[model samples]
Target: MKIAGRTFVVSGGASGLGQACVEEICRNGGNAAVFDLNEEKGAAVIAKLPSGAGKFFVCDVVETDSIAAAVKQTMEWVQETGKPLGGVIPAAGVGNPTTILDRNGDAFSMDTFDFVVNINLRGTIDLVRQCLVHLAKTEPVGADQERGVVIMVASVAAFDGQKGQISYAASKGAVASMTLPMTRDLARYGIRCVTIAPGIFESGMTAVMPEKLFKGLAAVMEFPRRAGQPQEFAQLVRQVIENGMLNGTVIRLDGGLRMPSKI
Candidate 1:
């Protein structure tokens, strides 16, 4: 599908990789809805875009009411701008480090594990289901017969999970595993699904890390010897939307970095 004059909803668009997507969409002549809970940050992101290029919606992915309200607002925008909902990117997630056992060998907190799974896996599914409702209503765009696209953010942990990543890996693994089946299920409606399993990238989550720890993480990269940039992620998002044949697959955005057993 063409990026210009189209609309996309980006979860977690208030910061990090999602913010980059909102910026890139506007820069490429498309409009975006910044779906996030942080009103202040979301407004800031929208403010930087061209007027009418994007808007912010207060949304919590794990809450049904929040997501429903945001979708309603987005549909209103679609009507106002006369642009079809062409894509969605689910980039909201948490990565709190946890192990199955503590120093004293006590079992890990089940609450923490549940929280991670609920936000990362269940939240992503909810957002996609809601977006698909609107996307399916729109007519297909271009000769590719594409009604919309969904790009989910998985992680390298889904494959090469290390110590303290059990919950996070399980959540991301589900996201990656659903790509092909989601594509097949949505085939009749012409909506494509793809996943991006990113490696160590410079994001809000990583920004607070100490210099020594951050450098040590980047040291494992096989080439370029640095963390991936947010723009690079956004670039791939744009490419997937433009390239119709990229459906039903997971693309690893890591720089040839196979994470070790522990951090």
Candidate 2:
């Protein structure tokens, strides 16, 4: 589970939490296959990494063929770099604030609900499965015969779904709920599964929130009353990868923030 000399597949690696993870991995002497749709941002991220430490692949996680193609390209890059696939991080997600009934009392848009679910829930699972296809076949690396790890990103909203977060909460909750079962399914292959449920992190999803709402979220923090740095999230990701005992569970990266029902 060592980060050094290994390659990790990271979705949404072009920015925010995923970008921090990519930087952290490169700093620790590992390689990252960054799967993202933004070519410019992807290239910028790769440019900052150590030479040969990162590569970007254009991938839209909602598309099955896109993920397959990215995985193929990643393996080929892995071969070139001589780094074994060590982990997978499916961090690409989106959020939409929509109530069951609109301001005019109209029913919720099914299209909006579907779009959120498809990206946040289905997209994450698909990326992990696609990467696991190859990760399972890799040679086991340590005394535990561990092949790789999966670090999924969830949100505190999964547990504390305030008003207008039905779709977002459902998608993230499913991710947290699937951790144990997915781990069990992959255990024999020496692949571990764990999910991270973060609260009020400085991610793309939070950046667009109104100033008042953002401040309200900060007020809920028990200490260091502020948004979490992306690096802090990245630190936990590294810990999960190196610690063999962290499997089959969802770890909260929140700073003691359970999130109020109104926030």
Candidate 3:
């Protein structure tokens, strides 16, 4: 799928990996509807891009109304402009520390557990459904009639979620697990689906970690000895959009760092 002049919807594009993806796509002459809850950061990201190449949509991925509205707005924008809706990048996610066993050693708060799943897992599904509806409208003018491309961001924790990461890991793991079947299901629609498992990225839960802990984490990697840059993750997103053959596989963008049984 050629990216230039294409329109891609990037959820959580206000900062971190999503923001980088929006910038990267814009650089390739693609337009992006950057979906994020942070209006200020979303505007900031939009400001950094070429005028009219991108715009920000304020949205909370967990809400059905918000997701639907964002999708409607994006589709409307494309229809008015006569641009094909490229695809969706569901990057909005949340992580909160809550042990399966609380201080009293009882079951963890179901509320907390539900929060993670709702934002990370179900949110992706919501966007996937909305994206497919739009992607189906794209008619291939040439040999490449690719309707759309969907990229899901998961964590290496899905493979080895450490202690206290039960919720976070489980949510991320759900995203990873859905890749293969999602690809198969969406394939018939001319839509490609791929999952990216980033071991230790420079954002999300890891970004706020103390320097000492971050360094200790770097030491655990098999090579590269560092957390992945958001740009690196964005680069892979670009590859998924450009390389039509890559589909239905979860690529571990981690620097060979397998997380330990903590965090």
Please report the TM-score between candidate 2 and the true structure: 0.98
Q: Runs in model 2 with CA error above 4 Å?
A: none
TM-scores of all predicted structures: 0.98, 0.98, 0.95
- Regions more than 4 Å wrong, model 3: 141-144
Per-residue alpha-carbon lDDT of candidate 1 for residues 21-97, written as tens digits (9 for 90 to 100): 99999999999999998899999999999999999999999998889999999999999998879989999988987
C-alpha displacement of 96 in model 2, angstroms? 1.3
Cα lDDT tens digits, model 3, 1-263, are 88886899998899888888999999998999999889998998899898888988888989989989988988888877677888889998877757799778798888999999999999889988888887887885447568879999898878987767788888999999999999988877788999998877787557776777678878899989887788998999999988889999999987888778752
Sorted on TM-score, highest at the top, how do the candidates line up? 2, 1, 3
| Local accuracy by lDDT, each model | 0.92, 0.92, 0.86
lDDT for model 1: 0.92
RMSD of each candidate?
A: 1.0, 0.8, 1.5
What order do you get sorting by lDDT, best first? 2, 1, 3
Q: What is the TM-score (0 to 1) of candidate 1?
A: 0.98
lDDT of 2: 0.92
Give candidate 2's error at residue 142 in angstroms: 1.3
